[model samples]
Target chain A: MESVLDIKQLTMDFGGLRALDHIDLDVKAGEIAALIGPNGAGKTTFFNCVTGIYKPTEGDMFICPPGKKRERINGLKPNQVTEKGMARTFQNIRLFQNMTVLENVMMGRHCRMRAGIPGAILRNRATREEEQRVVEESYAILKKIGLAEFVNEFAKNLPYGAQRRLEIARAMATEPFLLLLDEPAAGMNNQETKELDELILRIRSEEKISILLIEHDMKLVMSLSDRIFVMDYGRKIAQGTPEEIKNNPAVIKAYLGEDIDA
Target chain B: MNTIKELKKSFLIALWFMFLTFPIMVIKVNTVEQTIDWRWNRLAMVGIFSFFASWIWRYLLQRKEMGQKRAEESETPTLTFQQRVLQNPKFTRPALVVICIFAAIFPFYFSMYQVNIMTTALIYVILGLGLNIVVGLAGLLDLGYVAFYAVGAYSYALLNVHFGMGFWACLPIGAGLAMLFGIVLGFPVLRLRGDYLAIVTLGFGEIIRLILENWNEFSFGPSGIANIPRPGFFGIKMSIHQSLIYIYFIMVAMVIFTIFVVRRLQDSRIGRAWIALREDEVACQATGIDKTKTKLSAFALGATWAGMGGVVFAAKTTFINPASFTIWESIMILCIVVLGGMGSIVGVIFGAGILILLPEYLRAFSEYRMLMFAAALVLMMVFRPHGIISAVRRTYQFEGSPEKKASS
Candidate 1:
């Protein structure tokens, strides 16, 4: 499989704290990769470092856009990283609460808009046409996420699972080649988790986008992830299919051993 | 039946002529002392005439062709609640452009007094845009923004009087001073948010005012600096005797330039960072937007504009004083932002025009002018609490990269 992301010798430190130690991982294109870790195992830190939330203390990061040679990406700002075909959602939902769900999605389209400040302010025809298209595209994305009815509703008002879906939809609106999801199933119960697994599958296949998901839920991760990477003490302990990871001794010592159904 | 009512309205037209004309006919304004009966009677006559005229027009006139050609096409049709607040083309951009052009060109077609009022309105527009940067875009409540205005005025006054500098030279120097003061002020209250920021800014404004009042040796005490130079193009002073078309041009030019800078700043990456900060400060920082730098830059930019405005005002009026840059001035500018719509460039101008210029017409209303203004504000707020222009939905179509761009 073609690699969408390649991280080598990635090290992220918060002063005295090593949030993510020297580690490496790769997510293949058009596949779901679950990053499983115990609490304080730096799953989110790794995610952030990749998405440019925290620039790696030292590392080489590369993104392969399908047929091209893997392009090196390091130390860019989060939005810049997003502009380079990457999008991310926070552990807790970070939708623009006051903005409507559709508007929230439309904000992601900002990277795509060609009309500059003057064009929009002057209300040029191209800007107007662009705005209309954004609205329509946002509406379509909301419908895909099954939140079309709530398109006009403020993001903060959505249900927890719905907000999670909306966050995904918003990130998708950016048309990212890689989606980094931090705890998509956090606070979700069994039913939502089930629906999410189905949604994730549909998105990976239909959008043709690779996903890097941080998940605490063992069953969902084991079942849904095409490749599972286990982390412990800020280091990648093992990476393989769910069956291989299920039996790895280092992975056992790390996150899954305690949580996995025997 | 409605036609008779319409006839009554047309008959009421004579009354409107009486109303609009009678005050000028009965007692010439600017007399300094007018009979009480004349002022009271003129106001009553105008009110009664408008009351009947509107009554007939509502029943008789078609929905589209309303009174006043300007109002006829621009008035928002009555809409359902959601549509009223959340409809496309709520603000017709072209209509606004046309209206702004008319406003910009109006001095050429108006009396000197009207031009004077418009110049004042333009000053307020600048102030409102400045405040919008601090309070609207950056989401930082600044009660002391007017303090920078005072600083700019004082800077210009002190520089021009002592150094014999021209208005053009003093302008940048005044703005630099205001920017310095803004940085000083921003440093103290940088960590604060919401009402705390508001109160701190308010205190700073008052402190500036007090310093100006007490600094007698340099500031000329309560009397103020007078005989300040008015701006001139080459050598032509924008004196009242001059065509006034020239001053109008300057005022229009200032308005245009100020709005352009503000609009540019609002769309840049920094603008998005400011909005992100406004939306959620923690998230903004997490996304690598430096909160301190962003906040301070917003303050500096806002103050720079206010300072520039103060210099022009000092030059335009040919005077400077602590009295002119009062706490009331700060509050009034803040009101214009709220009345117009926070985070909207055009909203601030709309609010400034109504707040500053409308009172000129209500001059005969005397004691009632302020009361009527207050009522009008209340009415506008009741109807559109979000101000006249709200969210500017800026979207990127991505048509260049994709084949699915939607039409506006």
Candidate 2:
């Protein structure tokens, strides 16, 4: 499978600390990739760099959407990155709290829509049709995410699990080839996590969109990821199939502790 | 026991108020006669009034807290009475019709002075709605909104003075110029947010005023440009009363036009982007919204309304001065947006009417006008921080929607 996202020698610095150093990650087309790490291991920093929230100190990043040419995306703004078929959800579930769920999803379609101020004020036929299509499309996404019932409810009023799914639905509304989720299952219960596991699989199989997630849930990561990359400090400590990662000594050491007898 | 405790609390509050007002209410010194006159009766009156007022204040506070608790505890929160009334088309449609009818015949029934006051209220209504776009929807704190108003007014005054432009022509010119200024102001303060953005916009407003004040040759100095012509009526000469009514109708038409455009814009894609931008900047960007573009558009669009309002103002007053475009005007406009409910159309209209008309009608008690305004604002903030009518999000309804459509 061809890799949809290619990151080479990604490095990020905050004053004296190297948050992400010499890290390389690849997310193949239609595959679920997991980036797992210990508590200060720079997993989110990697996502931010790829999403263009923070300019990497030094690196080259390229994205190849399905059937589209691979393009270098260095120094693009966050919105520009999203416009280039890459979308992200925050670690803290940053849904527009005041907006309704459907509106929140429609917000994802903003860059794709072409209604300017004049069009908005005039309510021309084209603008009206585009708006109708957006509503229908956003509603479809909400239904798929099991948030159809709360479509009109404010994003903040939804339950915690629903908010997480709504974020995914919102990101999907951008119609991205690569979706980056920063801890989508952080606060979910076991049942919610199980549902999320299924949802992620469905997205990859049905939508043909690749995913890169930063998660602390070992079971969800171990089960859902096609390939797992383990990071300790700022380096890519290990990368392989889940089976290989489960047995890797370095991965075990980074996650658990070293055996005293050994 | 609880009653006694409550009474004791009220008594303490009254006592505290008495102490605070002792010099103002209880002591009166006659400078001419050099004699001190102690007003024990006034002190007693203040004490009794405060003693009862404190009781009502506490009771309302308790009720508010309980209401909040109930809202939180409920699975689906009950709609407020105001929200219910607003949400029901059955109520709102007729209410709107009644208001329209009243607005149409108001000038015909009332004196020209009253019509003039109503026109002023209508101008504030437009101004409030315009400011609502920035401070309300976009969540940009623009303490210098009057700067854009000044730009609009000056654009008209200067163009009319130099090029002999008419009010009808200067309207769009003023609005366009204000929008240009909005974009200019928007560029430098693009990175600022919250308090910093407010301070910068405030400075921008003051800068406009100072330039107009000090530039004697350019703006006619502090003496101002007077005798600016009112809007023409197809070359027909009219009496002052006739023209005042004419101006009132012109303002009415403009206000309706503004409301129509603003209402349409509120639920559009650009408006959604603005609300999202207001909610969370990073998330908004992550969702594929260009923050710079959204912010600048907000500033420019907001200033467009202020510009038109200003032009209308110049035409209505037939005068222009820097002092008239001071920070107080910006603050008053901001107050209208806030007190009426940010991002809410009807709230802004009601706020402008109450703020502008109340002062006009209460000219007999002019001495207590500011006092009443300040007291009303304080009471409003304490009781309803979201303004008289909090903004309700627009709900999209479609034929193929799964469940019952949500109504705002």
Candidate 3:
């Protein structure tokens, strides 16, 4: 499969400390790639760079998206990255908490809207029709995400699991080709994790989208992802299939923070 | 499709067509008798037509397919024009066409006093739209926006009075001065969020007002500069030479032009960016929207309009003092934005019209008119915090546009 994303020598510096350094990775078309690391291993920074949140201090990242589309999205705006069919979920939920769930979703679609102000202000026929259609489509996505019931509720009112899912739904609302999920199964119970694992799969296969997930959950990274990259201090130290990664000595040492008990 | 529905729909459609075209037929005969007759006819027509039209529309909208219409009826959408337009494209354009036509000819059709009233209202319309860019679109609370207005007016007044320059020349200079003040204020106050921002702005307004009050050197202290020069087009004063009636048309033109430009901004990418910032500041920064640029743009854009309006206001009255740019004026302008539904151009116009003119019109209730306005405003906010209008969400036909993801 063709690589959808290619990062070479990606680095980030915050004054003196290096957040990310000389990282290299690739995500193939329609691939579910996992980035597993300890808490401060720069997984978030990696995701940020990919989504254009943080401009890498030094890097050449080439993203050859599926269907012959290719670009360097390293320094693009977040919305611009979204415009290029890449969307991400925040490590901490960043929903428009005051707005209605539906309104929040509509906001996700903000970049795609073409209707001019007059059309919006007057709610002209075409605009009305489009609103109905968008609402319905949103409803469908919500139902699929099991958030249909909370459509009218404010985002802040949602439960923890639901809020996490809501962030994913919001990111998905952008209709991205590449999705970056940050600890989607974080703080969830075992039952929720199982359900999230299923959701991760559905997003990858059903949506015909690729995923670069930052997850601390070993089981999730082991079972859900086709390939996994192990990061230590922002560098890609190990890369292989899930089974190979589990056996990789370097990956275990990085996670265990010292020599593992033989 | 149903019998009563079809008959009722046609009747309502006929009435709508009549109401839509009424202003065109009735206004600008340039004769006394015709104007009176047309005025009464149009008023009577609107009253009778709207009553029946509402009845019929209510009847037709009860159909199963119009679920949203049903919702709108149950709880009046209270859409500030922006919301309605955003939510329903079908309702927006035709309705907008009607509003544009009315706004175009309102001065022509109304009395001279009414024209004068509308001119003040148009000035507010410009102010409201400018503030909408700041408070509504960008979600920045600007309490001292009128300070910028004062700067614009004073800039024009001082420059013209001292240098013998024309109102036309001072327009840009006034806006530039206002923009400068906006950036100066924005830089310091941008650090403060929400109420703190508002308080800082409130102080800013008062500070400017006090400076004007005390500044004997330049601002002429309390006496204020008179013969400030009324704005003229084609070298004719709106008051005596041009007829406030024609001035009404000009004010209407100004309001429409303002609404036009504002509406365009609302649709543009920059507009979306403002809204994004409004929706979530963190997301905005994370999205790579330069916070400094966005904040300053709102300040500059808003001040630019208010400043230009100062030029118009100065020319319209041909006199201005520090008293005109008081804290109360700032509050009133804020009320216009809040009451009209922040961010909505038409809503602000309605707000400015009601708050400024209606009180004047209610001479008998002069003492209590403000009370009534306050009561009405309070009720509207409580019942319809979205304002008289909300940000219209335009639905597109294309499936490419993402659905409004109901926030979690």
TM-score of each: 0.63, 0.95, 0.63
Candidate of highest TM-score: 2
For residues A1-262, write the lDDT of model 1, one tens digit per residue.
7899999999998999998888889999888999997899999889888877777899899999776677888977666777778888889778777665676776677677666545644666887787678778878887788776665556666779999998888788888888888999999999999999999898988989899999989999998899998888898888999999988888776643565564
Clash pairs, model 1 backbone: A113-B396, A129-B408
* Candidate 1 vs candidate 2, TM-score winner: 2
Q: Which stretches of candidate 2 lie over 4 Å from their true place?
A: A257-261, B1-5, B15-47, B397-408
Which regions in candidate 3 have their CA more than 4 angstroms from the true location?
A1-87, A95-180, A185-212, A216-218, A226-262, B1-111, B236-243, B399-408
Q: First chain TM-score in every candidate?
A: 0.95, 0.99, 0.95
Full candidate order by lDDT, most accurate first: 2, 1, 3
Across residues B1-408, which tens digit of lDDT does each residue of candidate 2 receive? 278999999999899989999999989999999999999998888889999999998999999999999987876657899999999999999998998899899989999889988988999999999999999999999999999998999999999999999988999999999999999999999999999999999999999999999999999989889988898988889888888889999998989998998888889999999999899999999999999999999999999999999998998899989989999999999999999999999999989988898888878999997898799899999999989999898776656553443341
Give me the displacement of residue B157 in model 3, in angstroms.
1.3
Residue lDDT tens for model 1, B88-150: 475566666887889766876778877777788888898899889888888999988899999
Residue B269, model 2, lDDT: 92
Better of 2 and 3 by TM-score: 2
**Candidate 3 lDDT, tens digit per residue, B71-179?**
5454222334445464577887888899878877776667767777778888888888889999988899988989999888888888888898887788889988898
Model 2, A108-153: lDDT tens digits are 9999999998999899999999999999999889889887778778
